[model samples]
Target: EITGLDDKDTVFRTVPSDDYQGRALARTLKEKGYDKVAVAYINNDYGTGLANAFKAEFEAQGGEIAGFAAHEDGKASYRSNLAELSSGGADTLVIFDYGDGTGLTILRQALENGFFEKFVGGDGMKSDAPINELGAENLATFVASSPVGEKSDSLDIFNDAYKAAGGDPDAIFVTTSYDAAFLLALAVEKAGGDKAGVSAALREISNGEGEAILPGEWEKAKKLIAAGTAIDYKGAAGDHNFDAAGDVPGTYALFEVGADGFEVMVEMK
Candidate 1:
């Protein structure tokens, strides 16, 4: 009946959860010994939630939030907000926004003002498009964290599967969406293709009812499932098993923007 798939049993994750990312970022900045930081975010769920999370975590870590700025959607200019962040006495600036165009606009303004020495971004800015839009020279001091990439050994499997399926394995969304599809398919198959059965199967899978399937082991998982073996799918994004909060413990990598592309700086635990 698809009843169990409601907000309760069903998982709702944005690759890297804003809360986790925020905390991790705070920890990273603290490790780097930053005292004051400014936050600039989009006026949306993605941005606001992440900014709040970062602020809470940073404060808990004995860091101060120097300033906070939110930009409306469709707003092309971020000069005013950047000005505020610049004058906020922050050494580091955190950005929580999506889209290369907006990110470039904000970064350009921030750089022009000479407000921050380091710029950090959430998963929303973990794309090549930003560097492409702003030019690498302008993004030299920018960094980001995201749930995708080859941070884990398990990603090898997902990469092979994606290529076999004629897809680009490096595309963040592609691997995540593929893993979701595989999990759904496995559940359905275990439930004997019955929707009700699938719902029941999800609980079993979530509760450690089988061997964990790491990325690239989907074919092995399919065979095991066919052989009446239970399986737990550790996805390319991270472990697909959702906790009580309906959130999965995902992996994220800190990336530095370079002239050619982005390089992985650190993988968060």
Candidate 2:
């Protein structure tokens, strides 16, 4: 929703934008080198946007989409649509949906019915439902494209504090929430304490302006701001440098289920 708000002072993101996510999916599809693909998307804006983006990129990369279908969300079953999607002789199927509950059921049902063995998906499939339902061995053929951060020393400090504060370090968006909250607070302080001043302050402190501020150094950060120091606040998730469009670029990776659990197959560049 916050995309293309470069003219305004709005900056909103805990996760990646949809366009990058589609590119991530396309990247994973190319990595697996599937010549023919089929798509099963949730009949919604999110799914449609991803479907179009993935279709364009995948085809541009010399891949063929043999079939495409959209299934309603929250349905008990999608066997009919799954069968149709897989009937085009495509070796790989890409399902685009919020997969925790609705899409997981469909994927498992498709697998149970022997619809297809290989799949390429997005961050929506980052949940445990797929593995829990299909088992890791069965899900080994599935590959996921999603955001994953590079290893950072700051994450250790934040994770330590997170555990102490009764927060689950393994939880989704834990790092993002922490980073955003602290960055907003720091920006507010630097902006002289008001929503009116926060927009510019956020950019001032985040985009490599002055001295680098690491995690757990908020007190020092405040002092530096008080001293008229334009300090850059690098959180546990690394830099929060919002660009001209108030969007921060993030990394992508391919995730696949292994014997134990999800493992990073490759960090996409």
Candidate 3:
């Protein structure tokens, strides 16, 4: 979504692109009745991509972008930036930066100076650092959006098996990473260990058709591959049905800082 990398057949992401995430955030804010907002993003690829995507979607949805600007990372001060953003009289601020770095600093300054009445962030701001450092009480009106794995029997099985293997299923992106590796292995098997055939074989396995293969069903997948039977992998993350460009549509959820940590408030459409 950022660099048009989807055009490369050999390149694919187990994670969804920022395009999906940005649209999700925009739609979520609109659903929550925030018709006007400000945006502050770090001056980098990830930040710029999300910020631009969100701006486009928000404006198209009849929402107003009152303020928009980019700031350098690791800055000692973002007050100027905040002042500019708040100049538009937007009560809500949408941040697209890492919560552990510049995002935390910006949030601190914003809160200290009362730059905005509410705060929202992208997946990068979903880190625990903000809530831990700033205190959950101070963030009652704060929320963040992040990609979430769809719940299914495949996910349940992965959770159970991962627990048995002493792994944390809830760790960020764990399911997606697992699915990446598992899918690669299946592709290799289906391709008869031929590297040149792996890419094509990948799509053949998970194109949203054929017999379903759940997590930890490696043996079954191997047997089916050996017998030339088509198998569709139902990953812990999602079905991972790759489109022509090798990109998969993703799911997202809105989260708020809770006493225990970030808690899901709603699934974003």
Candidate 4:
């Protein structure tokens, strides 16, 4: 029996990874010619880390970080922070929070204070609940950048496998989580069921070597893996190549809430 071990040297990732997501968002905002940006992130590991990465990248690209704010999760009020952001005179706002409920709260408060502008969000802020909560009218000018799940070739196969496993393939996080599980399982299988071996196998597969078993051109990668090839796995989140910082490179899609719900503005690959 393998007991779960948390080793400092052994890094385990649970999702699409934040570094890529952060960079993608920064790049998209810069490309849109937004010189001044503000960040309001949740006070958590994921939120703070992503915000910092976004700030670093945005500033590096000759962009200005207008303001940075932090909100604790489960807090009821963001009026103070929103007021600060409004006073900052930022044209673009990047929110690194989660769920539609929180988003609605922030949006509602911001709108009430007349802080209307081009609002952007991270993956966690991509949800229909916010639109439903604040009503489409309130969110008309809001946009969010999230990992493109449907755009991933692996997601197509992961959807099939998820259905085969009696799961809902349409649920965004569920399918991606399923893909993560399958990736781990495949790595374990290739490692002969050794946990350490599995980790190594994952690194190998992620580095672009291994039998692409999930979907798309993964099969072609099998030869490379057999030949000890280092390959990057373009996952369900789009372009999940592990970077030197142990972060997976992914892509994001810009979405806006319109009368018809969330509509895709552009794919930031």
Best by lDDT: 3
Per-residue accuracy of model 3 over 1-269 as CA lDDT, tens digit each: 53366455887667888888898889889988999999999999999999999999999999999999999998799999999999999999999999999999999999999999999999899887998899999999999988778999999999999899997676567788999999999999998899899999999999888899999999999998889889999999898988767788878889998887888999998
Ten-residue stretch with the least lDDT total in model 4? 1-10
lDDT of 3 at 220: 91
Local accuracy of candidate 2 as per-residue lDDT tens digits, 1-269? 45776557666564567777786677666766777899888888788878888888888888888898887878787888887888899867888876587779878887888888788777777777788777887887888776655467777888888899997664455677777888888989998888888988888988877998877898999999999988987777667788666777766677888876678888765
Clashing pairs in 3: none
Model 4 residue 209 CA deviation in Å: 3.9
User: Model 3, stretches more than 4 Å misplaced?
Assistant: 1-3, 6-8, 163-168
- Model 4: lDDT equals 0.69
Worst 10 residues of 3 by lDDT: 1-10
Tell me the spans in candidate 1 whose CA falls farther than 4 Å from its real position. 1-8, 12-16, 149-153, 160-174, 211-223
- Best-first order by lDDT: 3, 2, 1, 4
lDDT of 4 at 237: 48
Error of 1 at 262 (Å): 1.3
For each candidate in the order shown, give its overall lDDT on alpha carbons. 0.73, 0.78, 0.90, 0.69
TM-score of each: 0.85, 0.90, 0.94, 0.76
Listed per model in order, the count of residue pairs whose N, CA or C atoms clash below 3 Å is 2, 0, 0, 9
Tell me the deviation in Å of residue 243 in model 3: 0.8
lDDT of 1 by residue, 183-267 (tens): 7777777787887676567656545668887765657877887898778776676666665555566667688876557777777
TM-score: the better of candidates 1 and 3: 3
Better of 2 and 3 by TM-score: 3
